[model samples]
Target chain A: MDETIEGSFQIIGGNFANAGEASMQLKSKLVELGIDEAIIRRAAIATFEAEMNVIIYAAAGRLQYYITPHEVTIKIDDMGPGIENIELAMQEGYSTAPDWVREMGWGAGMGLPNMKKNSDEFKIDSVVGEGTTVKMIIHFS
Target chain B: MKLSSIVESISLEVKTGKNNLQNDVTGVYISDLLSDVMANSKEGNIWITLQTHLNIVAVAGLKNLSGIIIVGNRQIQQDVLQKAESEKITVMSTPLPAFEVAGKLYQLLNG
Candidate 1:
């Protein structure tokens, strides 16, 4: 395969109604492009987790996707109160989400870990007062 | 077994997406957390949950799930029902708890 396709989506924080819309659209595009079903599922799940993070934690964010013959790359940057402890955040069952957020059946403290589990490669960086940025890559064979 | 069969066997109420009742269900995942379902649920699995959000339909679509069975007869908002219908994902309901529905589904699929 020889191709380059790139897309970007903006996510508003606290937008519960459209939380996972970006991931759903990305999954549909992958399906239309005939990506492997397994790969698509993995990428879709990862994307959804990242998208939810933006909605639950950030003020606003943007998710960018770049697809090539070899891999799909997702870069998400959000403006919000960043994580104080990256290591603790990566641990499952550690969440800072408020009660209202959890009431929506999310904020299970699984978002970042779940994204890492689904992606072939995952990296996250955050500044306590600034924001967070995540880089995830999923390779296709 | 077909999702419709599961509905018939369990006497589930078809809230919407009835057209997709013939879809095959290969497995079942019981969860209310969206991320848990996203990370672990497999394609063609019948997701049993109490979530009545539109995002559930979106997750079911992205995961290619067979259908969603809302337990406890929780009222799904109109938008969620519409989204499930448009996604062509079967949405059903049961007054029983998630465990009871899961047990019934497991027996039907395994026995």
Candidate 2:
């Protein structure tokens, strides 16, 4: 395990077409770093869910990662209409994505649950009408 | 079944990479959305969709997908084709809809 590996991506809002870029980059990088596939998939799921939130919900956001021998941490911060109910939002099958988003076969509301399910540690903070911030960590241990 | 068989069944045109259709495939998935594909696709699965985008190749790379079959006779963006070529991702297209391709693949593979 490399003691130091880091990556950062600036995910844009409303660019639903390119929403998965960051996670894709992260996945390739992890493979190059020789990280475990399961670990890579876990981090990818969390980061992708958070990134998509920024694209569909937030106006824009940044996905930043901090890597170490022990863990891979991903943080997504977005500026959008904040969630009114984090608890309900965390539940599966809840989404507010636009018609086109759904037409593309997404917005099924499985994003949050899948993110949480894949990560070792997950945190969410949001203020209605303000914005949202998400943090996820997956330890190699 | 080999991609050659799928092509014959669906009347698909091997727009590029004819050598690619020679690859063996075990299953098929039809989806336009990228994330859903990322989560569900297994290696050696041929994906059929109407989505023609650059990122689709990236998703195929991550999932280790066998190839992509674009529906609706959609014109694949040039940039997307270039990336697919570099990645060695097989590309095929059919005028059929996503549902028909899915059904055909299911029939061939499941039978």
Candidate 3:
């Protein structure tokens, strides 16, 4: 509670079999830290969405989390084709995922929106032909 | 209602986490889409879906859902069941589609 808890998880892109593993681990860690139930749920949801994005689009990525007494911060950095239009990608029901991804009940274009909704602070940056980075912070009051 | 009651009432096949059948089911949310469930489902709600992938278990665990009902009698892979068992998330299967499963759950929980 007094000291900051920090950890990082490796994410393998295009690996549907293990897509949500990172988020699951993060959730377990948060639970172990005795964070509020509501806050842990929000943090887990946000982290899961971010993890899915990395797997569905990027080649690989790393998810890092820092939990302090004040806030929980999640950072995801991936290597793959970056979002060409952040605004368009942010729109609800707008997605560029392929047909195969759609059939799996994913690519709903709701990932980013869900992350933002669950986090008190959300930021995303991307470079075309490069990769993307997403940062989300949830405050504990 | 307890998950065991629903499982027996509807003849749902317990795939894994049989020990967790006593979990309380607060509500029902039917969606094949993972994000939709994550965004809307409440804790202790039993998720009804046709999805039988590994990520489904993760979603159920992350949301603290009471259990998952795989509708349409979809064939769930071994790894998914293994993960569900490890996470202690009860997963059941039904021959009926999502619509029928949802209807029956609604009646059981409300009627």
**For candidate 2, lDDT tens digit of each residue in B1-83?**
88788888878877655767778887887787887888888888899877665677888889878789988766666777888
**lDDT by residue for model 1 over A22-138, one digit each (tens)?**
888889888888999999999999999999999998899999999887889999999999999999888665677875686687866678888999999999999987999999999
Off by over 4 Å in 1: B1-111
Q: Give one digit per residue, the lDDT tens place, for model 1 in B36-65.
A: 899999999999997765678899999999
Model 2 shows how many backbone clashes?
A: 0
The weakest ten consecutive residues by lDDT in model 3 chain B span B71-80
lDDT of 3 by residue, B3-92 (tens): 899999999999999998888889999887787888999999999987665788999999999999988756676777899999999999
> What is the model-wide C-alpha lDDT for candidate 1?
0.87
* Listed models, DockQ each: 0.07, 0.06, 0.07
Clash count of each predicted structure: 0, 0, 0
Residue pairs whose backbone atoms clash in candidate 1: none
What's the iRMSD of model 3? 10.2
